[model samples]
Target: MACYTKVEKETCIACGTCGAIAPEVFEYDDSGFSQSVLDNNKGVQAVPEEVAEDVEEAYEGCPSGSIKLNDTPFKPKTPVSS
Candidate 1:
C-alpha cells in the first residue's frame, strides 16, 4: 500500500535528495554518507504525509531515481442494478 518501495543504495549516488525531501525519515551519517532511517517489511520508510509531496518531487528529481515506490493495485467498481 505504498508507492515508495525499494531503495538502491549502490545506485543512490548520495545526492541527498531523499534526506532533503524527508529529513525526519532520513539522515546523513558521520562519514557524510546519507542513509535511510526507516525500513519495514512492506518497504523501507513509507513516505510521510506531511512530506509526501516533497518526496515525490525528490523522487522525480533523483538523478539515478534509485528510490522506488509501490504501486497501488486498481479495483473495479461494481455496476448498479437497474
Candidate 2:
C-alpha cells in the first residue's frame, strides 16, 4: 500500500513543523513554505507505506491544517479550502 501527503501552501503558516516531524517526506521550499521533499514545490508525493505513521504525525502536528494525507495512491486534486 502506498501512502501520500500534500501540504496546502496557501494555508500553510510556513512554521516548518512538517519538515521537522518528517524530514524524509517534507521540507521547506525556497519560499519558506513546507513542500513534499519529492515534489520540491507546491505538489504532492507518494510516500512509502512504512513511513505512513510519521507522515500522519506531521499532518497532525500541522497547526495550520495544511498537511493532507490519503491512503489511496491517486488522490483527487481538490481545491484548497479557504
Candidate 3:
C-alpha cells in the first residue's frame, strides 16, 4: 500500500527530531524548519515502501506532533452524471 506524509509548517518547531530520525526522507529547509524531502519538498509526498518505517519514526518523533501520514492513496471523488 502507498503512504502519504506531510508536515504542518505552522506547527513545526524546527526541532530537527524528524530529520535526525529519518534523514533519508526528512530534512531541514532553508528556513531551518523540518520538511519532507519528497515531492520536490512540497511539504506533502508519497513515502516509498523502503522508507515507510523511517517516515513513521519521524511522525512519531516529531515533538510538536506536526507530522501527518495518510496510509492510503488519495482518490478524488467522481461526480455523478446529471
**Which residue ranges in model 1 land beyond 4 Å of their true spot?**
29-33, 40-45, 72-82
Listed in order, each prediction's TM-score against the native is: 0.59, 0.76, 0.77
Question: Candidate 2 — which residues are off by over 4 angstroms?
Answer: 41-45, 74-82
In candidate 3, residue 57 scores what lDDT? 86
Candidate 3 structure quality by residue, lDDT tens digits, 1-82: 7788777788999988888888888877888777777864544457878988988888988889988788754343378999
Show the colliding residue pairs in model 2: none
Pairs of residues clashing in candidate 1: 3-69, 3-70, 4-69, 5-68, 5-69
Tens-place lDDT digits, model 1, residues 58-77: 66777887765556422333
Given candidate 2, what's the lDDT at residue 69?
Answer: 78
Q: What value does the lDDT take at residue 36 in candidate 3?
A: 74
Error of 3 at 49 (Å): 0.8
| CA error at residue 80 for candidate 2, angstroms | 14
Better of 1 and 3 by TM-score: 3
Candidate 2: deviation at residue 18, Å? 0.8
For model 2 the local lDDT of residue 47 reads 84
- Candidate 2 lDDT over 1-82, as tens digits, reads 6666777889999887888878888887778888887655433467877777888899888999998777654445688899
**lDDT of predicted model 2:** 0.77
Question: What is the alpha-carbon RMSD of candidate 2 to the true structure?
Answer: 4.0
Cα RMSD of all models vs. native, in order, equals: 10.8, 4.0, 5.5
